[model samples]
Target: MLVLSLSTVAFLGLAQLADASGSPSTGHRRRTAGGGQAMNLVRSAPNSNEWSTQQWGHWAKTQKSSLEAKYGGAGASGTGVQKRATGTNYMTNQNGDSSYFGSLAIGTPPVSYNVILDTGSADLWLAGSDCTTGCSGVATFDPSSSSTFRNESSPFSITYGSGQAAGFLSQDVVQMAGFEVQNQIFAVCEQVSGGLLTAPVSGLLGLAFQTIASSRAPPFWETLVTEGAWDEPVMAFQLTRYLNVSGVQTLEPGGSFSMGFANSSLYTGDIDYVNLPVTGSYWVLPITSISVQNQSISPPSGQQAYAAIDTGTTLVGGPSSYIAQIFQQIPGSAPGTGDFESYYTYPCDTDVTVALSFGGRTWSISPADFRLARLTQRECLGAFFEIDSGGSSAPSWIVGDTFLKNVYSVFRYSPASVGFANLSAVALAQNGDASGAVPSATIGSSAARVSATGSMLPKAHRSAGIKIGCGLLYATSASLLITIAVAGVHSVLL
Candidate 1:
């Protein structure tokens, strides 16, 4: 599921689709802002989001840094009363699916700030007034100025694959999206290195569980759900698409990030719910099997191997062996050389399709998503990459925005689970124009491109809940419930 920060989850192992499986556990940093120009070629896309296939990768890299800190904790008591409010909260994505930012206010008067809505990690961190390295373009928070600020004095830090941030823990009246949490313990950076984050974003807001919070405190969103700030304990994301639209590199409306309830208008049909351990660390669920063009691939040990759904990630990665097996089934596919050593490339015109199943139900990904970037007139790089989720006990795959763009995603609490529903027709309206994506003029012609958006999908295997249930509202008898939607497109469309 999720670090998918959008979030990552460990897989225990898996049996056949017939067996209801469970079990297993396990495991970015900010980058300075500044990106290359996007290609402007207009081409057909499968889903609502349009990615930079020209980048030669999946929208899966941002969340990789935060995975190192495997901390766990429980929710602390809320500091103030609940503020039942709703308004338009916006997130910008100029670098394709690279990162997403939303409005978050802290302190008594609430100094508004922008943060990444990462479902991959669990701690809420932002640039502090005293921050050093890599603090160029982001707004900084001054703990001294906030009336509700409390100095915990405990040194706080999170290490990434290449960088780290050092600061102290502080509690403050924190507000985000539509809800606010009081005395929320968050990180205030004094020194940050390894090129953690760029401007246009102050920091990241983890939407995962409290179990993996680096601050060892309940994440801001979980606090809202745990205290019944809203009706249902759920947070959903409908990340739209766009890439370097109109030469603008930042502040473009990306999609919707909802809390408490799921937005019905954003999706269609029943929200196929994938159950997760309520006390689990990440928003992860089990995948019975994965297939390419109807060809099947399973976890090596036959155990429950999970796919962490991370929004911060740019590309999707899996065990090398399984990845190799997958490409072997695709004709003209081969190992890419240098720079792309672990990647695979296939015929530029190949309309490849990949399908995955949870609880016996299957959903297929669009072909435009499969082919990451074009290498020549006839060859292209694949979006799927090879990543070892550390050890065998960890997730075998990390599912990022690449796969999420094909469906509407929901992460629920209480009877913990994740929901993946098909997109509404309205949402898929611009599939050909790449919807949210604005291609740069450099992408050449669509004549050399490939897209399997119109390819036939594998028959969906039916499970009881597979085709049953009322669209993201699966028996909301949890004593509480609420619904929210930002704007549409230029605003929050969910």
Candidate 2:
């Protein structure tokens, strides 16, 4: 079946950054741009071909398990914010399920490809001209077509939680918006397998540090920073949500991303900043505590843990025991009946306050965001799931899009840190419509723009924030194992 792998977290053992030949730009250059450069982020309509089957849910589960085994539970390690340069921001397009993509041009004349602007992993890869098998709808990058393409001697291979890609490393001119980075190093895949074949993307551009990159090359943003492309050294994300418009629930492409500086208009309150520790090649944040409805929920181990913020992850994953503890408080919450053994379904409109504290401040998620969908007349599935990373001591949470859509986030570099602010009133329209009722008019008067930005490869998971229909898509079948991972804090959707 065709699937949208989108952004899956695939964890590679942490390593030192590799040196690249004839680099795009040196890091010594100083940037001068002063204001935030904003890019339009569009959300694509869901694909029926993908959602109609149970494959996505099963794949997500598998990917999630993979992540626990790779970097969660016991093996998960600590994680980078490097000095950034003045860079041009590019527009992002949301694809099926967990995928948010953008366009970039490569080669001499510049051939554009629709790629995932993932902050989870730190490698850039696309189908090369030689990929004839399983590469049907993707845009392939050809070295022969560019005058500036430079071939590297090193062979490259990247493994996601559910798929794999292998090829040779090469360098060329990479372009975003109107900006260009000369001799940008990237991987050109001659072969791809598993869930990646079905993903609705041509390639992936990882935004993390070089430690986790498969090709070991500095990310495109790093190259931009080295070239002194920004007035500031930051990126921000204003992830949009599913809106009900004119009595129809629509997932519109309405989010924005900014580079170099923050867009004050996208947020309502002050930006709360926190230091980021690059423990294991990820933007890992220390969690002070977790509370449900203002009451603290203790984990099975009663130990404090950290959370890795990942854009590539679809769902918010927690330890199995902690997840059970959190959901136990909800009346009528019970085990799911299908391939989703790792998930639970609770009563519709259940009132519960879920919050995570990072850097001493707590950010609460709306109750409305918890409901995945109605299972029966009064039952609704939840967005949270129980995942066991064999080594319980590893970071216990993979905070994904479910929580991200509710806030405006900034990813700062040089001395890596993460910042959060309350989303503007306009961006909160989806949260305000708690009933999930489709409205008669369009929502939001102005475009919702924000910035701070920053990977993993796994079989991608579905976002819990999107509404699901109780149809043939979720029928119970034989037991299917679910798992996940990403390169740095690589996580899966459940």
Candidate 3:
């Protein structure tokens, strides 16, 4: 299956969600980034605790269309399952696989602009200095003002699941986290769909490999690493938790984006390195198996299952067949009605446990991280949707933030592998869980149809993603979803 990826700007990693635990690999040693430098990520967008039926339905619509545009349409919607312990949230921190925000300077003299670091797609784009559209109040870049800015003849345009962006290509120095990449190619987007560019965040810093790059230039992070800025070509993240719990929540506490090493303070125990397929550009890993509670889901004969670890993707999507299988095991779960075609809804209080393995170990997602939103007091949306990618070499699953916040994630380039570990008890203590006791559903009513509004994701947003193996780039809507932020170490299976 030549499966592509779908993503939000800040997503990915594993825990009990799939190798999100205490698996120790001797060769996997941890180190601090060169110069002890760490890239600080700011929390820019505010989260919406309110997710009405209309919003859920709209999410299903845009997400389904996004998938169909590439992986073909999915079957009828399936049921839902969940066990979170918190309130409503979108993909921004608070442990619901939310968007991550940070600042990086581009152009010769260096002008800092807020950007979202994404791992799903490969492109670095920012708002042009021109006033208009999405670039409104947010900071914009002026090509003429920078002495080192180089112009390219190529016109730049990218269409996402919800909106679109058009601009031109340019080259300049991109410096972030104390590391600088000279003459890095990026997009200076002039026109953007509304709601895409909000205050504090003006562009996307895609961390995916160059093969998928729309501008066809080397990625900023990769360039810095290969250029000998660091001995290890590794980038790791610990997204802050803002979901349920008591008292005031600090927006950016505990959440960090780092390069060349893992933060020991954020996670506990040793990290395990999972081997990835060398044949692909995006991060693709094999899944040993999946299960709902105690029931194991075996793929059809000759079928190979791979999960795309995308930090930029906000939601977790998989084959309809598998999603259906997952919900069938959870009682009181059903497909959404009306415009909610690809999403599933279930009793908010069901103690449903979903787990996945990648040959070496199995991991699980906390119930809080599994629940996307509440359509009603009794029924809520499941974070995992259906993307129906049923062919060979394609990714059967796109693992995004919903599963990422449960564990500390590490993406390394040299060996070309991904790793995960349990969040330290201290880190977990500060973050709250999304799986609160939402009113339990009365089976029948839980399956009722819900209304919809517009796409929750924004223009050129990389929040919810589905990346194809090779082709043109398609965009996804971006929004904030909050659930409980639970991080813990899993006992080694040995």
Candidate 4:
């Protein structure tokens, strides 16, 4: 399992500034250009977290579309225009057989091998068979055997807050739906370790739109948009844990990822969109504030930072100090005493309210979502905040399902502007809950639905780990060793 670490907090913090104040001239605006709302592309710095001076110029040179356009509306045999396919099938791997994969087709030959569909990551990756791996469960793609394979050895690596994976860059002919694209830039992990290999997927297919793609390549989703394969550059997802269990499923061919649009019924029409500031090459956003129970807390002043809004992360993470302050406000939240500083807990039954103040809006999380998991009695709740020894100074945060459950988020990026739309409660109700939990089916399949049931971790294991860690830490401390030993003895006697 990927040990979701605290280092991601800095990245999240940087992305929160998507709407920070900036000059209209310097930021992306929804303007009528080229007869339509042309998306203005912003490039991140060459080797830093800031946006670079080269904006549209760099994108124009590097951007590749996955679709081809036809003139007019082409019928089955007519010469009218038809749009090329831009999306691909995302899959899951179970045991060792591709047929047993979760969301993908059982018998379809993979157009692109070693593909990964990850909720905890924003970019897709594939490994060519030639790469290196000392670990197990790694799949390799034989590009030569596939008629749609293309290689572009750009050499890439993505370092998460918890660990790092390196691989070579290559392009291959990829097919999904009715679309076929040649030479797409994808990464291959040559050496991967630290439990990430255990995931049931071969590689990563990031669902987050292009805005947050790693610097090595253009986002796969954005590549399709730029090619005019899509009418708009927008994508939306309602992920339910159990429903997504198999992982090899694909969206219906004509279904909309719904780029640049919001389902108004899910939330209030009050949309908070921000212009990203160009700080070097990276597009950076500033987080103004964070809160718990609707009470706002001040962040480090004058430290203008940028972050990427990532859908791949499971929890909101940031710098230790910043995270510490945020968690401090929660009534029963506490730090872990283990080698991994990324674990936290709280009373299961506590009615907690956690909110993030960003882009002039307060995004709140309810008690049900804040509680990591329920105990055997289904009465106690566990806290979800994690601290990382690696993220002591970086100002980043990953806003995952914990907070997204209460809102309907839409991500859009075109030449005109890149922003998100929040929908109203009506839409949310129709889509079920935003929390990605599996619903109990007291009824039959027709009435089955996803429901919130707290965190993924089992309560018993959590409690045991906490007890053991606390016992060890307390027993080793000079001031508490004797006292803890005495308490242990006394407890045994009682």
lDDT of 2 at 133: 54
Better of 3 and 4 by lDDT: 3
- For all predictions, the C-alpha RMSD in Å is 16.8, 10.9, 14.7, 19.5
Name the candidate, 1 or 3, with the larger TM-score value. Answer: 3
- Most TM-score-accurate candidate: 3
Q: Candidate 2 — what's its lDDT? A: 0.49
lDDT of 1 at 431: 33
**Taking the tens digit of each residue's C-alpha lDDT, what string does model 1 give over 461-481?**
211111000000000011111
lDDT preference between candidates 1 and 3, better one = 3
lDDT (tens digit, per residue) of candidate 2 on 1-494: 00111123211111111011111111211121234223344332222222322654554455455444334311101112233333323232232223344446677666656554555555567778898554555557788999988887566654444444567777886665334556667778777653343223456566666655555466776655544455566777776654212222222343555666777767877889898754435566777767886778763332336576765555577767778877887878887646667788787766767888786568887675565444456766677776554444444566666677778888777657888999887556633232532101111111111111212223133111111000001111121222221221122221
Instruction: Give TM-scores for every candidate, taking all chains together and pairing residue i with residue i.
Output: 0.72, 0.73, 0.74, 0.55
In model 2, the Cα lDDT at residue 37 comes to 29
Cα lDDT, model 2, residue 353: 70
lDDT of each: 0.49, 0.49, 0.51, 0.31
Candidate 2 stretches greater than 4 Å from native: 1-36, 45-63, 66-97, 197-200, 243-251, 299-304, 392-394, 429-494
Candidates 1 and 2 compared by TM-score, better number: 2
Which residues of candidate 3, in runs, are more than 4 Å off? 1-4, 7-35, 43-48, 67-97, 244-254, 299-304, 390-394, 433-494
Candidate number of the best lDDT: 3
Q: What tens-digit string does per-residue lDDT give for candidate 4 at 383-409?
A: 344323232222244344345445554
